[model samples]
Target chain A: MDSLNSLIDGFGTALTPVNLLWAALGVLLGTAIGVLPGIGPAMAVALLLPVTYGLEPTGAFIMFAGIYYGAMFGGSTTSILLNTPGESAAVVAAMEGHPMAKAGRGPQALAAAAIGHFAGGMIGTVLLVVLAPTVASLAVDIGAPDYFAIMVLAFIAVTSVLGSSRIRGLASLLIGLTIGLVGLDQMTGQQRLTFGSLQLADGVDVVIVAVGLFAIGEALWVAAHLRRSTGEPIPVGRPWLGRDDLRRTWKSWLRGPVIGFPFGAIPAGGAEIPTFLSYVTEKRLSKHREEFGKGAIEGVAGPESAASASAAGTLVSMLTLGLPTTAVAAVMLAAFQQYGIQPGPLLFEREPELVWGLIASLFVGMVLLLALNLPLAPLWAKLLRIPRPYLYAGILFFAAVGAYAVGGEAADLVILLVIGLIGLGMRRYGLPVLPAVIGVILGPAAEQQLRRALQISDGSASGLVDTPFSVTVYGVVLLILAWPLVRKQVTRRMAARR
Target chain B: MTTGTAGPTPGPKRAHWLRDHSELGVSVLLLVLGVLVLTDALTMSVDLTQRGPVGPRTVPLVVGGGLLVIAVLLAADVLRGGRGEAEGGEDIDLAEPADWRTVLLLAGVFLANAVLIGPFGFPVSGALLFWGSAWALGSRHYDRDPLIAAGLSLVTYFVFDSLLGVPLPGGPLMGVV
Candidate 1:
């Protein structure tokens, strides 16, 4: 009943003409950018962050939420149409989707993807509404030491599990931490590593770093690598799904949300794992296994649904516990903090309007996305035909404008360029950029909790492990950190035996 | 595509060399970066805590120590010639060479913005910024391209200036925008 009332209140807020317009705009821009290869939701949000600076907090967040989900929808189009995936989560979709396109059943493949996205998105939102409060209440009892332990666990999990190489991921994370440590030390009010510069007093904006790395670096990389080709646009054909297609896909859509939600809620579990699992599940379960690498509609439907559901599931954890499961969630967490509204257990009590409004807007936005994407997917496909040179150049131009708009400081442009180069290097070296992003966003918060815990214990090293909860949290962290090594050893032994 | 090719024993000697050398290069770079960060963190002034056992240096020092350990491990792995499967193996072959022409064109666009933003102001410069990028991207259909870019820049200008009140640089052509 309480959830219902709050949802209704949220609908009231979201239905306002101004808020609705923002939601529509967010989804539109998110889909457009999401369709672009190499750009993801995090980059899209970061690019739009500067532009949203002046909107009311509630309105701004509503739009941000729309863009986040909109990216998920937009990503599937490229994955299915082209073999190229705009986001890592879309990789599974591409495996089956591209084959389906090649078989000339492109429209059916896209229809299944859209319908599956709708199903998963709706289910995930329901879970969020019901689970967020309960989880947030549990988080309220956690002390500073426990928080510190959890952050350590987060850092370890993200660096080790998210990327191809643990060493490179950790290195990238440390680099982000180093960047976070720039400017004034939060505790001492003393400037450290500022090198006697006034601009350094204010720490580098995470938004600027994110935008520069994702948008600017992506633009530069695209500009330098994109081939200019005028390929004929893939014919979208009929948008409607046949009865056989519908019957085959509905089960996968249901199965996907079930499989994806829990993974999205977990710390290290991202969209990629669930999406891959969903794809494999569909392949193994399907009556038509031979069609999987050909033009299986289930193959396209399952993973696309899983990806969108996982995206929604990430929001549940983010809004309630302030733990971001993906890069976009991490950036959104920063955006929330920028508005001075910490999203946690207290958010429901303190700002019910904002929380519910954002949630309601998501439901509305999902519907809007379906309406826009389903009938007009062909138009979106035409977006792919845009020459690479102009697309990338536009990205760079917008990135520069966004960076300059933030602080009006000339030094920011230099920082943007430097970070862009670092981003390029990370991409080249196969380092996961998400961990670095997470580290930067969470570094200060973790430091604050650690300092607080130390103060409570009177600076004793044992103080960190003194409490039962903290001890348990540390134990969990150790287990997570050790799991990879232990698993590797087991795998090696098994390989030797084989 | 032949499964019977040499019983699937990793790769050729040249492949092994390439793998080991790249890892070595990366390990060296990581070590350098780790050491620089560690030294910088350690040199910062720290106030001793009379009441608590932990101080401001705790987290950085721990992170620094962790980095050093990882660096050492990475170095050892690289030196020992432990070759792992190449990352993104599927896509590596698909990647094409860098397009320098597009890079230069984009660079020119940014340079133009930097030079003109202060003098020509937001309206004129903003329009050029949008139009130039659009043109560069391959929208040779100038009839609709410039109009679309101009509209986008104008809306952006209004949103930044009027709605959000972000105080964007209007430059010399401010009133027109």
Candidate 2:
């Protein structure tokens, strides 16, 4: 009931004519950018960060919420039509959705996805409203040692739990920490790796790091292997569901958010797991199970909603815990920090209007996204027909401008180029990009908590593990580390049984 | 398709295998970066008052040490036939050989943008960045691309500087627009 009242008040702020317009415009821009081949929600938000610079913090965050939902919707559209997902979360949707496109049911797939996004988005946002305050209140009891332990847990989870190789992920994360170390040390005001440059003191801006990695690296990679021709783009019509399609999809719409929100609310629980789980569950239960590989509506419907719910779930953790489980969330966290606003347990209490307003806008953003994109689906497909050369050139062009515009220093462009090169190298070497991003954002904060924990203990290391919360978190971290070796042994025992 | 089987290509393929070992480049990079971090940490002069048991140097030492271990482990993995697969995306074609010339050209364009943005301001240099990048990416519309690039730069300049009040420098045209 308290959450309901706050949400109603939030609507008062979000529904202002100006804020409403920004939400619509963000959805429009996010969809346009998200339709591009390689751009993800993270890149879309990073590139568009400059647009909201002129606004007040509340309105700016409202626009960001809009962009987040829009990117997910746009990514689903592309996956269905082109079999090219802008991010990993949408990869499952493409497996069935693309086959539908090939079979010329492109419009139906889009319809299902848009509706699923709308449905999951609604359910997830409601849960977020109801649950975030409770979580934040629970989080208020957390001390520095527990905070440090949680950050370490986040670091271990992102590196070890998600990626193909833990070593490569850890290496990427360490490199990001090194980059984060370049500026002044937060506690002591000492320079760690400045190399004695005045510009180095301020540190590499997160926008520069993000745009450099996702935009510039992607452009360079594509330029090196530019495919002269492309797959025949499926022509899409207005996305509208028939009676049969609705009957097939309504249950999935409910089930998806139910599966997605829980995973998203936890640290290191990325959308991919719940989304895949949704799809597999749907496959096993559907009467049309045979229709799945051949373009079943349930495959598109289930995963699309699951992914959106997962996106909402990530925000719950982001708003309350300051833990970013996805690349998009990490970038959003950086954006919050840029405005000198810390997002954590204190955030809701500190800025209730902004918090509730941002959450309210998610609901508003979903309605606007579905209403706008359904009829405009064909136009977004037309965006994909944009030639490769112009598209990439524009990416580099904006990246340079955004990098330069942030600090108005030519030095930033240099930093941008260098990070872009590093990003290229990371991609070439198969390093997972998420851990590095998480490291850069969380690196300084982790150091702060570590030192503070020790300070309270008068330099005793046991302070780090004194709390039960810390012990439990560390135990989980150790379990994650040892799981692969344990898994091999378990499998061998099973083989012996066989 | 014809070029694929054009000759007894012990050529690009074998050279690729030999160059495959060049992945040690990443290990070398990690080693160099680790050494740099450690050297910086070790040489730091700290005010004694600022010294906690864990000071500024502590995180760097841990980070640097981690980098070294990972570097050595990665090299061993490479020797034992572990390879990090190059990332694939919608636009990426891993089968195609990397066109280094295009990449180098793009980097040169960016560096030029960095250098020129200071003197020439955003409009002139931004146009150069867009146009140069387009050219590097193989857009040969020399007749029309320059006009579009210039247009884009001016529009963004007006929007960001005039409307948004970001205070972008206009260089020689400082007073004109």
Candidate 3:
């Protein structure tokens, strides 16, 4: 009932004419940028971060919420039409959706995707409204030790779970930490690695890091291997669903949010797991199992819903715990920080209007996305036809401008170029970029929590495990660290016995 | 593609050996970075009163030590025949030898933007950056591209500076902007 009241009030704020316009504009621009290849939601958010510099925080965040959902919708459109996924979460969609498109059911596949995203987004936002307050209330009681433990959990999950190689992930994380350490120390007023540059005093901006690593580096890497052409986009008529498709998809839509919501709520939140799980579950349960590989409507419906649901779910952690589970969420965190807003337990209590308004905007964005995308997907597909050279060159231009816009310092551009080089190296080496991003964002917070916990315990190391919650969290982290080794040993022993 | 293959033909056995151990280059880089971190941490000046129990030095030291351990482990893994697969996530083809010519050209474009932004302002330099990058990426529309690039830079400058009021430097165009 309390959540309902807050949501109603949130709607009152989000539905205002100006905020609605922002929401619509956000959806429009988000879908446009998200349609382009090599640019994901994270890059979209990072690139546009400078544009929202003038808006009030509430309006800006509402626009951001729109963009977030808009990117997910746009990614599916590309996956279906171009067979090039804009976001990793949309990879599953492309698998079945692309096949469906190839079979001359492109419109049906697209409709299922947009509708699935709408259903999943609505359900996910509802789940968020019901659960966020309770979660925030619980999180408010957690001490520094538990906070530190949770960050450790996040670090472990990002490094080990997202990428194939743990070593590369850890190395990437270390690099991020090094970058994070370049600024002045929070606890002590001492410089660590500034090397006497005045620009280094304020530390490297997260925007600079994000734009450099994602935008400039990606452009350089792609330019090196630029595919001359990305073939013609599969043409589609207006999206329409048949009776059989409707009958098959409705249940999967209901089931997807249920599977996806919890994955996003966890600290290790990512859409990949739930989407894969939803795809496998739909494959196993669908009556039309024969169409599983060759483009099943259920495959499109289930995973798209799961992906959007998990995106909404990620907000649970970002808002309540101030932990970012994905690169997009991390950039959103940077946005919040830019506004002098800390998005955690205090955000809900201190600024319920802002928090709830942002949440409410998610709902509004979804309806707008479906309305805009269904009729305009072909227009969005036209973005794919953009010449590769101009597209990448424009990306570099924006990246340089975005970096330089921060404090209008030429030094920022230098930093961007260096970081862009590092990003190129990481991509070449197959290092997962997310860990570095997470490490840069979360490293300082973890350090603060660690220092605070130690200070409270008068420098006792065991204070980190003083509470049951912290102990359990650390135990989980340890198990995550040890699981591969233990499994390997067990497999070897079983083989020897055989 | 013929020119992009790794250096003039070596014996098959030697080529395989080099291919397997190529990752050691990365491990060596990591080791060097670890050493640098440790050296910097050791030389960091700390006021006596500012030294809390953990202090600023602690995290860096730990990070440096962890990097060393990771480098050793990575080296061992490579020796044990572990391999890293090239990413297939994007439209990129990692099997193709990097076009260093293009990469270097793009880098020069960025450097040119950095050097020029101060004198020419964002519009002029930004146009150059855009055009240079496009050229590096193999767009040879020398006639049409500059017009497009200048248009993009001018619109971008006006939008950000006038409508948005973000205060980009005007440089020589200061009066016009």
Chain A vs native chain A, TM-score per candidate:
0.96, 0.96, 0.96
Fnat for every candidate: 0.38, 0.80, 0.64
Note the Cα lDDT for every prediction shown: 0.76, 0.85, 0.85
List the candidates ranked by TM-score, beginning with the highest: 2, 3, 1
Query: Which CAPRI quality tier does the interface of model 3 achieve?
Result: medium
Q: What is the lDDT of residue A152 in candidate 2?
A: 93
Best by lDDT: 2
- Determine which window of 10 residues in candidate 3 chain B has minimal summed lDDT: B1-10
Which stretches in model 3 have alpha-carbon errors above 4 Å?
Answer: A267-269, A486-498, B1-8, B11-20
Clashes in predicted model 2: 0
Candidate 3 backbone collisions, by pair: none
lDDT of 3 by residue, A1-498 (tens): 999999999999999999999899888877876777887778777887776576788888888778888888888888888888877888889889999999999989999999999999999999999999998987777888988988898889888777789988898898888888887889886777788877898988888888888887788778777775566789888788999889999999888999888887775538888988999999999999999879999999999998889988999988998878888888888888778787777789988989998999998999999999888787788888888889889989988878887788888999999999888878766777888877887888899899899988989999899998789888988888898999999999999999
Highest DockQ among the candidates is held by which one?
A: 2
Better of 1 and 3 by lDDT: 3
Q: What is the two-chain DockQ of model 1?
A: 0.31
Per-candidate TM-score against the hidden true structure: 0.89, 0.96, 0.95
